[model samples]
Target: MNLFEDLRNKIGKSVAETGQASKRMIELSKLNYKRKEKKREADRIAEEIGWIAFLQWEKEQDIRVNKDLKSGLERLQYIQNEIKLLDVDIEKVKSDKLLYSDNFYPTSNSPSSEPSALLIYLCPYCAHQVGEEDRQCGNCQKRYY
Candidate 1:
């Protein structure tokens, strides 16, 4: 009666939580992939801007007052700003700590070659997921321990 109902509740909660965590991990992986893609794009844009700016300066002997140079500079600044914006968005993703949930296992006496568990880290400031080997939190960009 009451005991059976309580057991059912506990089992239901456990199953639901496991499903939610699995779904969350999939979403987090997708978000991180997109973040890395944006970073790559920003790096490419920066290189292109540097090459254009250097060529313009070399050809014109001055970059302060040329119309075309002014336009190029504006474009470069725009892309740089875009990179900054991308970084901000990535930080926001990192700040969502639920993305970094840990998977753990119960202790077993049977001998096995594979490890039983792994450690998952959270950003100290924003509580976002971080790696044990990471130098800084991706979300807050802060180093903790």
Candidate 2:
């Protein structure tokens, strides 16, 4: 048996399947974390709603909810909507992973095309893609927090 040829074949096969399935799973995890943060924000808004209502009651005995409480409730609703959208995004990521097969071949669009996932920052205002070391976004010219 040609030992060198066998070794090369095995290594080539391993290199071909870089496991996008795992990458998608990792992305799903990040989406879940974002969803959890939104939920926490909603909880905080709920607390603010209650406190504002109590203050209005203590002042003049008005049973009608004030604009402050209504605004807080609207904010809570917006946060919940965000959480739902995240859930949809998580599902889409998972479904895309399902399309992956173990016997995949290498294409020009390989894993090397992807930058280091940890070495990039997305702009909060506009999608100004930049490296981790970048302090400002090139497209939007916004300072990264």
Candidate 3:
């Protein structure tokens, strides 16, 4: 009876360990998938910005012939601003994905026991915790309150 009990205990432990390992593997896989998705999004945004820049350059060439330099310059500036905003967005997405990956697959052997704050940085303008810090708020770009 003792031998049978010990065998059953060992088998149960092994099954539990295997289940934990499988769960960990799935979590790691999810992190990898998220990282890849973020990279793809960044690449797409970069390509879009590149195309916009090229179009603006072409428009500038047209302006020289049509004698509408001012409008062309303005449009170019707008496109540049848009590209900057897109770049910032792409960076933010990438940063978020990395943070998520870190939280999912921590390097430390011991798991964190403390509860993490769900709230991110509060917007200086509107006092909203939007989980990102930037010069302008996504909701309201007001520089000052």
Which candidate gets the maximum lDDT versus the true structure? 2
Q: State the lDDT of candidate 2 residue by residue for 1-145, as single tens digits.
A: 3434545655654554555446667898999899889988989999988888888888878857668877888898999899989999988887666644434333345544322122235667776556678788787798876
* Residue 126 alpha-carbon offset, candidate 1, angstroms: 48
lDDT for model 1, please. Answer: 0.60
As for lDDT, the candidate ahead, 1 or 2, is: 2
lDDT of 2 at 27: 91
Tell me the tens digit of each residue's lDDT in model 3 across 1-145: 5435545755664565456556656655665565566556556555655565567677774322232444444555655565566566556655645654532433236765422222246567766444454656666666533
lDDT of 1 by residue, 30-139 (tens): 76676577567657666765676788789886645456555656665775676577667656655543333343322234533432233446667876656778878777
All models, RMSD in angstroms: 19.3, 20.5, 23.7
Q: Note the residue pairs that clash in candidate 3.
A: none
Please report, as a residue range, the 10-residue window in candidate 3 with the lowest summed lDDT. 62-71
CA lDDT of each prediction against the hidden true structure = 0.60, 0.70, 0.53
What global local distance difference test value does model 2 have? Answer: 0.70
